[model samples]
Target: MHLKIRHRTEYRYETPVRYSIQELRLTPPQVEGQCVDQWKVSTPIKASTSHDVFGNLCSVFAQESAYTSMMIEAEGEVHTQDAYEFIDAPKAVSPYHLLQQTNLTEPSAEMLEFFAASLPQKNTIEEVLKLAKAVQEAILYFPGQTNFATTAAQSFIMKSGVCQDHAHIMLGLCRASGIPARYVSGYFFAEESPNLASHAWIDFCLDIDKGIWISVDITHACLIDARHIRLAIGRDYYSAAPVKGVRSGGGGEALSASISIAKII
Candidate 1:
């Protein structure tokens, strides 16, 4: 399937900003079944592009002049496969490296207990799906209950969060079980609501030797289909956030984001 994606982020500051630099992982990678037909990032200044350690396309831009607001937009067309599994090619980092847990993805004792009790056997695709279903049921999708920095343990305690939290919780569980899993940031074409286009999921390594992985949408408790567009992969949301930056000024900032994904017929 072909998809057209547009993402725009705006930031308004109560005070003038002096200097700022932003790192973007907005560009999608060309994987086995996914192709980036066209992509671009629009910023106030020229941006330099490079690949990150995880092989994600990175775009960086800095603004030096004082400004009250900043706007960044990315638009593109992509082709995706209807297949559920995604076999990622081995990059500079080894899949085993993902076993190490970050603060955001660390599983709590209760989470480990839940995993042990709920899933006592090996993790086949079906078993993983079962785990995903359990996760969705355990954590009700309650928006505004969590933020970007919320950890898997915290959300598990609350029993509610959005997609990001769901992904983090899944990552924590998989990694704790000795399964290699990574966070995926991307766009989901939700027919029900355009506001739910920006999405997050997980890719657990099915076979490390062959770079085999399966993409699962934890919130939906299912494998990713053509409606999913790949963006970036990382150990946690902080590493794969579409937009992250540091600013010298820009106090009391108000931020807004708009994302749209449409079928290209």
Candidate 2:
């Protein structure tokens, strides 16, 4: 399957920004299960500077205008490729591990207990699938209840959250169980679905002899397919935000974004 994507983000500031620096992780990497035939990003505002942490950036400073718009348009052809063998991406080498090490906090005792019980028993793919499904059934998908900063234990205790929360809870459990897991930020298409939104999920390294990192979307209760377009992978949302930045300005700021995607038949 092939896909084409268009994403646009606009910013209107109440006060003129003296200077701003931003990091973008919008470009999708060509991975084992996906092939990028062609890709490009166009920004209306010429970037003062940019580099690849994974995406493009447009750094601006001292704009005289009070309102500004930053637009990024990307078009690409991506094909579904065959799955690769799952390799042991330990915490030491795994990107997620590196992220966790930098940000340390205490894990809940209840979460630790759950990890102890779940990891040892999940020796087969079927067992892992069952656990993921259980999480889906146990949690309700409510958007406004949780934000990107919400953690796994909190979501588990609340029994409700958006996709990010679900992914975090699931990823934490998998990692605590000694399985290598990472967060996936992506987009999903459901034929003619009007309410398209950014999606999140988890990819866990399989224990089978072949070694595969199978993706499990607890929110959808299914394996990711052609409609899925990956942006970045990390421990959680902070590392994978489509756009992150810092501005040298005081006063309130607001942001708005719009994304559009079309599939070629």
Candidate 3:
């Protein structure tokens, strides 16, 4: 499948910002089953690009002038394979390294016990797929119930969240079960609504013996394929957030974002 994606984010402040610096992980990459045909990034200030630990293309932006608003825009085209078996993914990091949990993704005792009851056997690809499906069925996909700071344990207790929360929950459970898992930030082209394209999923090291990886979308209850465009991989949302920054003097921030995905005929 071939598609075009446009993502835009804007921030408004009651008082103009004095200065700010930000790390942006907004560029998608060309990987197994996906080709970045053409892409561009636009920001309010000049930005520099580099690769992170997971080899994700990232950018650094800074502004010294007082500004009441800020915006970032990304537009791109990708050619994706309908299906792929990930046997050739880069294996630079040890699988065990993924088990180093973060605060937001720390599995609670309750979560572990829930996994014990729900996914008694999660050792094989089939079992993992079942776990993904089970998570989707268990959680309610509702907005306003979660925020950017919500943790996986909290989401587990609430049983309601969006894609980011879903990925964090799956990461916590999979890591607790001794599976090497990473968070994936990407774009999902929906067949129905073109308004929402930003997406999140999980990548677990299914077979360390053969360096095999499986992409799971717990929110969608299925493995990701050509429809998913990979942007970044990290331990949690903070690591892969499209924008993370500190401002010297931006009173209170009001943020608005929009995304659009459409098939390119």
Candidate 4:
């Protein structure tokens, strides 16, 4: 399938920023069964492409001068297929590296208990599917129930959150159970139900030595296929966030984002 994606983000500050630097992971990867026909980022400050520790195609940008607001726009056309099973993909790092938890993806006592009782006696692909389904049934997809900084424990306790929270909860439980998993940030195109085109998911590396990473979406309660276009992968949301920036001076920032994804064919 061919898809067109557009994402825009704006940051408004009450006080002008003295200087700002941003690390952006907005570029999608060139993986098996996926091809980037075109891609671009529109910002006042120019950026040069680079890769991060995880091999994500990224960029770094700094404001030329002081400003009260910042805006970033990304547009791209990509073609994807369902053939990417990561069977022969290059191993970037040992999947065990993801066992180390971040604040957002850390498993809480409640989550650990849930996994202990809910996970099947044997860990198999079917067992993983059951776990994913359990997570989906446990958490209601409510947008206002959580925020960007919400932790997996917090979301798991509430039993409600967006895709990001769902993904984190899955990551936390999977890693805690010795199942290697990582966070994925991307765009999902669903023609019938268009909402929150920007999405989050998790990829479980059941066998790192075999170079197999299976994409799973607990939010939608299904395995990801061609409709999902990955932008970046990291230990957690903070690491995979589309934009991370620091300002020497700025106060009371307000943020707004808009995204749209359409199937070209």
Candidate 5:
């Protein structure tokens, strides 16, 4: 399948920002079954591109001058295979590195006990999807109830969150079970609504020595299909966030992001 995608983020500040720098993981990588045909990023200033430790294509840009607003946009075309799982090549970071829990993915003691028996003994697709099903059932998909900083434990206690929360919960459980799982941040082409375009999922390593992984969309309770476009992946959301930045003087900022995915015939 071929897809055209555009993502735009805008920030308006009540006060001028004297200096700001942004790190973007918006560019998708050409993995086993995914190919990045063409891609471009638009920013207020020239951006430098490089790869991060996780092997994600990243771009960095800085604005030194005072500014009241800023915009960053990434647009691209990609072709993907219909397969749900693929063997990713080895990276600078070992799959074992993902087993380390981050603040966002650390599970509560209650969560660990709740999923203790259900955690997959073998990292098989069938067994993992069962875990995904249990996660989706346990956590209702309710937006606005949680934010990016929400932890897996918090969301599990609340019993509701969006796709990010679902992915984090899955990550926490999988790692606790001694499975290597990474957070996948990407675009999911939904025929139903544009609001669902921005999505999150998980890929648990089946054979770490061979870099084999099964990608699962916990929110949907299924393996990733062609509709899923790969982006940056990391231990948790903070590492894989499409846009992350710091500013010296921006105050009371209003931020908006838009994502669009269209399937090409």
Candidate 6:
């Protein structure tokens, strides 16, 4: 399957920002299951800066904002390829590993406990499916209850959160349980809506006899299909934000982002 994606993020500030710096994981890489035929990144302002997260080095841009409006636009053609072996991506493939490698403090006691419990046991693709089912059954997918910043532990305690929270909780559990898992950010084509919003899920490396890596959407309760288009993969949301940046001014600000996607049948 072939897909075209358009994403736009606009920031309308009540006060002008003096300067801002942003990190973007917006560029999609051509990988085993996907091929990037054409892609481009355009920004109203541009600066080149480099930062090291875990082992991956990313080139970011810094900009000065005198205008009240700031926008970043990306357009591309992505071809869905076939799934391949789960090669061990360098710990640098995602910044999520940086947290563990750098020995950053784990956030919640509940998260730590769950991680500990999963470690001793071996997990399989089947187990992941069962876990996804459990999560779907456990959590209520109410739209308004939680936002992107919500954590997995919070969602687990409340049993309520949007897709982002569900994905994060699953990622943490997989990682803690000794499974190599990462967060995936993308768009899902749903029959109920013509326009698709940004979505989140987990990709885990299964230590089967052949050692395959599989992608699962706990929020959707299925393996990724042609309807899914991946933007970025990381440990969690902080690493895979479609558009992320920092600004010097606009201490108090308002921001909005919207994604529109369609299948070319």
Report per-prediction Cα RMSD to one decimal. Answer: 1.3, 4.4, 1.7, 1.7, 1.2, 3.9
Compared with the true structure, model 4 gives a TM-score of 0.94
Model 5 Cα displacement at 15 (Å)?
Answer: 0.3
Q: Which ten residues in a row have the lowest lDDT in candidate 1?
A: 114-123
Give the least accurate 10-residue stretch of model 4, judged by summed lDDT: 82-91
Instruction: Give the per-residue lDDT digits (tens) of candidate 3, residues 61-81.
Output: 889999999989999899987
Residue-wise C-alpha lDDT for candidate 5, range 8-37, written one tens digit per residue:
999999999999999999988887668999
Q: Report the candidate with higher TM-score, 3 versus 6.
A: 3
The full ranking of all candidates by TM-score, starting with the best, is: 5, 1, 3, 4, 6, 2
Query: Residue 171 of model 4: what lDDT?
Result: 88
Query: Model 5 residue 25 lDDT?
Result: 94
- How does each model score on lDDT? 0.88, 0.63, 0.84, 0.84, 0.91, 0.67
Runs off by more than 4 Å, candidate 6: 47-59, 81-85, 89-120, 194-196, 208-212
Ranking by lDDT: 5, 1, 4, 3, 6, 2
Q: Would you estimate the TM-scores of all the predictions? A: 0.96, 0.78, 0.94, 0.94, 0.96, 0.82
Model 1 ranges with Cα > 4 A deviation: none
Cα lDDT tens digits, model 6, 1-265, are 7777777878888778888777776666656677778877777766463434422234477665376778887778788754523454453443234224111113367655544433326667777777777677677887777766777777777878877877877776666665767777877756575444678777787653343568888877788776677777666787777677777767667777777665555
Model 2: per-residue Cα lDDT at residue 265: 71
Best by lDDT: 5
Worst 10 residues of 2 by lDDT: 98-107
lDDT of 2 by residue, 1-265 (tens): 6777667666666666666666566677766667877877665445454433423232332333333444555566777643533343332244335224112112467755654544437645666667677678767988788766677778777889878877877776666666666677877766575344578887777743334577778787677766777777666677667766776553566666666666667
Measured by TM-score, the strongest candidate is: 5
lDDT, candidate 1, residue 56? 90
Candidate that beats the other on lDDT, 2 or 6, i.e. the better one = 6
Can you write out model 4's per-residue Cα lDDT over 25-105, one digit (the tens) per residue? 899888866799999998877897888878888888888587998899999999998743554236476787988888998
RMSD of 3: 1.7
